[model samples]
Target: MVGAPVPALRGKPITHRIPSYKLYFEYCPHGDLHDVIKAQVDEREVPVPRVRSPGGHMRVQKVRRADGRLVPRTNRTSNVPFHEGFVWRMFEALAKCAVAMERANVLHGDLCPTNILLGEHDPDRFAIWPTPKLSDFGSSRVIDAMVASRFTPPETMQMNFVPPELGVMRGDWEVDGLKVSHRTNVWQIGLVITCMMRLEFYLPETDWRTGPSSIHPNDELHFHDPNQRELHPHSFQHANCNYSPNLLALVRQCMRYDPARRPSPRALLQRIQARIPGSCGGMDTYTGDRNGSIPWNKTEKLRGLKKDNEWPLGDDAEVVDVF
Candidate 1:
């Protein structure tokens, strides 16, 4: 709602409704990535293990494999140890998104946690609705380099979750017809999972105890030092809860680094359905309030698919400089 105009403002302020006519194709109160997830989780959630590369974890802007090779980081829970049957429902839902995407041929070039919306609401608080329309498209293609520069100054297309072939053209893609592919969306989807689940990929370090800034969008997409607030799903809580790992992974798969490496939307659909063992029913709903807020666990950080305290658990004082 930060950017949306007030309903009563048409009379007092400048006119608008004309440009926003496209809102129908873009928004759905109960159909989004989040609803697809809420349709899966319950009170009892299976705990999962966090997975990261050798150097703690890779940054979104820059990802490397566990073996030190620069590679795509897609397949959200595939790399995680706790990805088995216990509580990987969220990852499956994310996989479903990809499956659903294939039916539409609309690639989610740039995927992240925010693009993932929640659809289930306790009717006691609001209502249970099912709106599984993938919310953000063209978002990846519309990155404001000036705004992006403030975070990591994005250069060299990401390869963490995409196909290796795309990596071959990572450098200077502007001149090449080498556009971000479907797999690219899949890669970003995986990252979205890592961030939504309690386990996350990276943590931003700006001495929150001293900096004039608060959490930035890139914070959910970056990680540099061992000493930083983690991006756990619990960190993004608002009401009394946050996203479950099963739900978190749904977003992560969308955030995969490589485009080709991503699961086709159809494949993602199969994966998510297998996890939930249900149909894409209207058991969930998520309509952003006019006020920029929602009900969930309240935390000030956005992490990947990892635990919070375990990140800096080691006593090795080694400082790896990402910059």
Candidate 2:
């Protein structure tokens, strides 16, 4: 399977006497997938008339209400859903990443929109950004089917992004017989895509009454209902944004509550490749050069970069000439 590129470590780690370490990574200018998904749901405020204030500064026009209270005029806005093609591209990119992880026998416990970062857009590769790197490996671990059956994810995991199997567990927080495998990654990839399609954060079913209550101490955590139809992509699909049946079916397959029923990462990648038109050549192909070609560098025409040493770091740190 053609594995997606991950963010490269720019330099070796910098160790300090205080037992702290610093690492530099490739800069992703467009931010993460969460930012992109948020942009879709976020309303772009319409420009409103401004009035000169007593201080001679332009300010939003205010109107007096019936109660004699002045309020700024509310700006009109509209939700713009992501394009169907863009969603498909994002799905394909993430699917490739899943395949890579599966091959390495690693399980990214936290696979969410925030963890999937976006690099600069490269038109020569894809209509949208060519590279969407899977990042933040702090929660990742080597996969072990036996250990996973008895494993219970920590409460810190992003509750909304976890698969139904992981989200809806026994009151004791035990996974029971459920195995966390590549299917888990598939579920998260589907969820991220679903969020992109719906243009909002996907909130799974939760019972607030039973959660962290004096009466139900065991039910302190939120549990999703696996049987809910809302878990399916079709339920949240927008009529205005008509995605292909194949894409929807693939996403649905990934979100299957039964981990054993979901497609493997390689299988998922193959399915995604089938939907994409033309020969699967270049970076998308499994046989393609993994490192020789630099697609992210193609962004030179798209934007200018700050001189290497001039790049900003935290107040406590300064740039070092590692080269």
Candidate 3:
């Protein structure tokens, strides 16, 4: 799958008159990372599902939705099919985007697989194939708001992209004195990378019972060399480093046991660049890559997308125009 035309709209002022006159924003067309994930999403949730949590608050891709009577229906919704490769592309894209936010002094505060979009795409019309657009801005609390919220959120509140150090505590802890900082963003990025590496387990939610969700980040039993090196490595046992060692080393850096050791966003961008030397635009970017082997030409034909049999997932998802 290729890129969807990045969705956005120019700002417009709306005049509203009530007690007096005030300005309002019209239907802004900017798309969030969450919307992008649901559009060409391959996974669907079941009301009786056992493991996975309910989806992100945004709409999810649809299919033969279930009801009491386990029967089939002919009608379907706007959700489009997606390829698994699109998921990796989504992460790569999000990484690139995170760079943009870093330049603007804004950390996503919530960077997960859901925050990354995975829209169905066509090659003939790269722009026309309903693409997944990254979304969600509600959890964004600036560095200042974080200062006030640091004093334990009220009973009803929950935090995102926030670390344990930033919350109110029962005792005088040295770490708690520290505030949420940009490095925390890198740690969140590590979570996204881990999820991507373990996509087979997380995407469909079919294996929820024995799924990755069952494994907690701090569970050492699961990390024992013999028990499972397949899921993640035992680097967590290493002094000063608690991340998997087998995967890409930089990602481990993102999950440094010490926040002070994490690389800055600028350094992260440089690392990403060093990996994919000239990876933007066209199939030229992926000749010998894993994404280069999909059989896309069999069915995809977006307006101007490059022709290449590189998309991994077949048309199992429906690309949609739904918000």
- Best lDDT among the predictions, by candidate number: 2
What's the lDDT for all of these models? 0.37, 0.62, 0.41
Residue-by-residue lDDT tens digits, candidate 2, 272-323: 8777664222333322135533342231111222232344556855766542
List, residue by residue over 1-323, the lDDT tens digit for candidate 3.
23432234344334445343332222112233444333323443223212334773533233353565543223332233233233334434555555656655564555554544434443432222334444454465555555333553521112223233332223332243445556666766665554444432132211222234543543322212234212244322213223223235666677654567777777776765554423323332333225533342221211123222333233864444321
User: What TM-score, over all chains together, does every model reach?
Assistant: 0.35, 0.67, 0.47
Question: Which 10 successive residues of model 3 have the least lDDT summed?
Answer: 200-209
Ranking by TM-score: 2, 3, 1
Candidate 1 on 168-270: residue-level lDDT in tens?
2223321222344445446555545543343333223222322334566445322222222133544432233334455455554543343343556666666
Tell me how candidate 2 scores on lDDT: 0.62
The TM-score that candidate 2 achieves is: 0.67
> If ranked by lDDT, best first, what sequence of candidates would result?
2, 3, 1
Say which prediction, candidate 1 or candidate 3, comes out ahead on lDDT: 3
Candidate 3 residue 168 C-alpha distance from true site, Å: 7.7
Off by over 4 Å in 2: 1-4, 13-15, 18-20, 45-77, 152-156, 168-171, 204-226, 229-233, 278-323
- The local distance difference test score of model 1 is 0.37
Higher-TM-score candidate of 1 and 2: 2
